[model samples]
Target: MLRVCFTAEDLLRVRFADEPAPMVELMLAVATLQRSEAVFGLWRRRMGRALTRSAGPLLELVPATGKGPLFLDPPIPGFDAGLEHVLSTPTALVRSELHRVHARDRAPSPWTRLLADRDRDSWQNLEHALRTAHTHIVAAPWERIRAGFDAERAWRTHLLAGQGIHAMLTGLAPTARWRETTLEFDSTDDVEVSLDGTGITVLPSVYWTGRPLVGRYAQGWFLVYPAVTPLPDIDDPTSTDTLAMLLGRTRATILEQLLRPRTGSDLVRDLGLAKSSVSEHTKALRAARLITAQRDGKAIWHSCTPLGLELLACLPESRGKPA
Candidate 1:
């Protein structure tokens, strides 16, 4: 069991992450991918089919059962910036973390030894692997991930408003319990932490479908737990090819991009199309009531309607139900 003793100050400092940190989410996905739990089987198989061996070096560092080095996932804002931070970890910290990982695993692999010794070539290979993995695993599903975060925030916010913090914390799961100022939950490690006014960030995870993860990080402490709500359309093999065949590639691409609100310029730049092409596609989309547009001064923002989202969620051959 993991128990966290919190002070009043710590309670005051408790909060939610506004946006899912890319590095943090990526690391969680990597760890979750290693799991053999039945709940994760479908997700793992799909991701495994999609991902290449480009992520091997990272996998070498983060074992399935043991905690990875904290430096691999600092509470940074941007994904690339976070990767840069991981690569630039202090030599002493790298050695210490790798040694800790080794202690838990009880084996001496060649990569671990070279990494512990601060080998420059090994570092380069690691950097390449991490970047390649991020491109494949996180890039495509990012918008859906962001949507999941938004849903989590809304759900938690409602809970906080209606019940209060104690109810919010203890209500995380059936087994989670609160002892006055302390919160306790099941964990692999039997650990206790006193949050000495350094309050923790409470996050709802989409990838980490396991027991609650409570640990101190570079920024501070984080209590990341699994979210009950699954991401809409994340599981479905996006029938983009079908959508493309129906809508034509450009229109289909524009429709997918409109999952989030975007301006004409945003579409043009993002899709690498001309301004006229975006305007033409959006006009057809709006005419069909597949999307809605709002005027924000000079810019007209376009977003997918429920019809559009439903269309994406349930298309022919999509594995999802038919619309």
Candidate 2:
């Protein structure tokens, strides 16, 4: 079990990230290789083929079964930076971290030579592998996945306000709970972390599975746990037949368009449908509580609600159909 002790000051400093960081996603993608959950099976197969031998050094960064060193957790403050951010990790820190993790392992470390001298070529290969994996595995579904992350953040913020911090902490995962001044995590290992007053940043990750992961870095200590909800596979075809029978072609098309939030003009341009027709369809969807429309200044933005997303998940993507 892992227990984190927090002071009153730490509670005041606790916060959630507004968006998911790319570096966090990249590291979690590497960790996903060890998992066999159904949600990740498709991603795992694709990554298996994409990961090259050049990225061999990165595999040693995280252990296959136990807790990985804090070095794997780059202390990035925000989600703004891209792959370049990770590639810029200080050379000294990298070398020191590599030795720390490898020193404890019984097997020969493939990265010892490079870490010892901070070899330029070795770092170059690692960068290439991470960029390639990000492009092939994470880029396509990022928008939809990001939407899920944003929704979960919103829900947690509301929980903190309505029910208090204790509820919000326990709500993070099934194994997580709060007792007096300390937070407890159910895991195989026994560990204790005291956050004197540094507090902690909680990140909700779509790729992280199983128990929560904890690490400390230059910025501060933080925990990355699986989000409460998983993004639905927009391509799943389980109930497409039923959805088509209930909602007609045009309305079904409209719901599919809203898979990612779009403004009125966006739907008009993409669908090549008249403004009035799109308005009518949107009105019906809103009445059914399937989709929601929020006016921002002059333009109206539309997006699928939880119910709308569920219905769309049941239906297949719209193929070539007449406007």
Model 1 over residues 1-323: C-alpha lDDT tens digits? Answer: 88999999999998987777777777777887788855567878877766546676677777775268888877667788898899888989988888887788656579878877889998888888778778866777776676666655655665676668886787565468888898998777888999999998987766665677776777889887766433322322333344543344566678888889999999888778888767867875774456899999999999998767865665535222222
**Residue range 1-323, candidate 2, lDDT tens digits:** 98989999999989887677666766776777766766567767766766756444556665554345454546463433555555666777767666666676434365546754767876676677666666654675676556656655765676687668887887676667778898998987798999899999988777665678777876688878776444333222233333432343466678878988999899889888899878876875775456899999999999998767865653345333423
Score every model by TM-score. 0.70, 0.67
lDDT, candidate 1, equals 0.73
Off by over 4 Å in 1: 49-52, 230-323
lDDT of each: 0.73, 0.67
Stretch of 10 with least lDDT, candidate 1: 229-238
| Candidate 2 Cα misplacement greater than 4 A, ranges | 53-57, 65-69, 75-85, 103-108, 231-323
Clash number by candidate, in order: 0, 0
